[model samples]
Target: MSHAHDLVPFFEFHLYGKEQIPDLSNLPEPRLFSTHFLFHSLPDSIAKSKCKIIYICRNPFDSCVSVVFHQCNCTIIITQIILEEALERYSEGINEFGPFWTNILGYWRESIETPNKVLFLKYGDLTGDVTFYLKRVAEFLNCPFNSEEEGNGVIENIIELCSFKKMKELDVNKTGKMVGKYENKVFFRKGVAGDWVNHFNPWMVEKLSSVIEERWVWSIFLISLSNTYISIMA
Candidate 1:
């Protein structure tokens, strides 16, 4: 499944305080799951296991805008806040699963320390060249496509299947609620990088940029990383 909430009851409880957790032991091996939990918070078993972990970090400016839309759209979560208020919260690292740099840096450090066990990907780089990154993911998972598969357009087919436009149009995604009250459609916005530009004013840009700069001042790697991602979109 794409997300832990899609299968595991433990994750559902952890994320939304739901009491009913289903039995997942019967599921087959090589099961893939995704989560937003920080590295420090993940189960001990996951850390000890040989399973590969891929962490995708996004540009903070676009992340903030997307999160605000998610929170505001899900009325059951909290009272909807305006864009200005959301920007302020994001500047302070106050959103859900936030302290944003901490989350990114945690996995980043792990990826460096144990390169085989963890893969760090930037959302901008993935968007900029999806086929390259998709192959990277396949290789990382030990399932690299052969020349014949590539020649047969298997890679292209997978990309088309998972494209935001295609997935958003699926009946399963377009209909029904998830995690109790969240409409499935809320998860599918524009799905494009750099959308923050449309919502952010000069002041918003300055504020977030200053925060990112301050947060990454000591880490030359992060500064370079952020610059590379931003430049890709530019």
Candidate 2:
């Protein structure tokens, strides 16, 4: 979810492509990778590889608010546009590598067709039940902890190590600049589920809901997400 300006510091890897080709030669095994390419546009090698791919998506409402904050805080040129203007550009897919719903379709369908290879996650569900998803992800990676490791709290240690609270407190996150335009610290903003409620008015919510439903109703993942949004807001 980190933007171009703050990606490197947030993920601790040098930022290279914004959906461009990934050059992963000579990288360490068990190397982590990140990209913003939509499923259809992903590199042929990666798509055909036996490797596992995990795609995490956020609720559209919160995504809007997050983009607004990041732009206002990080870029002087982007700061001039009001939230309303930004939302329009967002809906048009004119924002930063956006057209959010489009970016999701390929991966979303792939997750359904090849459930074992493509693991789809929601930011809401992950934060809501990190431990459960952590175990699920570990299992998918073929490194599930043995009973002895579970009893020894190895998973808990890993979760604690990567928790938002811990990451936010790290010296690198606090003091590092991303070698881009923005500070690393901005990527850690308000890591919560319902932050959209603070910025989105009733009309905005209904508008975004309609748009999301229209564009993303094909996948079971997005259908469930739309239902969750309705139930929570109701």
Per-candidate RMSD, Å: 7.0, 7.5
Candidate 2 regions exceeding 4 Å error are 1-23, 74-81, 218-234
Q: lDDT by residue for model 1 over 164-211, one digit each (tens)?
A: 898788777776767666677888878889888888888889988998
Q: Where does model 1 exceed 4 Å of error? A: 1-17, 20-23, 74-81, 219-234
Error of 1 at 205 (Å): 0.7
lDDT of 2 by residue, 1-234 (tens): 343334322222354424564455655578666667777776677798898999998888888888887877655543333766777777777865658988777677688778889999999999999999999999988898899999999999999988889888877776556555567777787889888887776777777888878777755566678768988999
Query: What is the lDDT, from 0 to 100, of the residue 198 in candidate 2?
Result: 71
User: How many pairs collide in each candidate, listed in order?
Assistant: 0, 1
Query: Per-model C-alpha lDDT, please?
Result: 0.79, 0.75
lDDT, candidate 2, equals 0.75
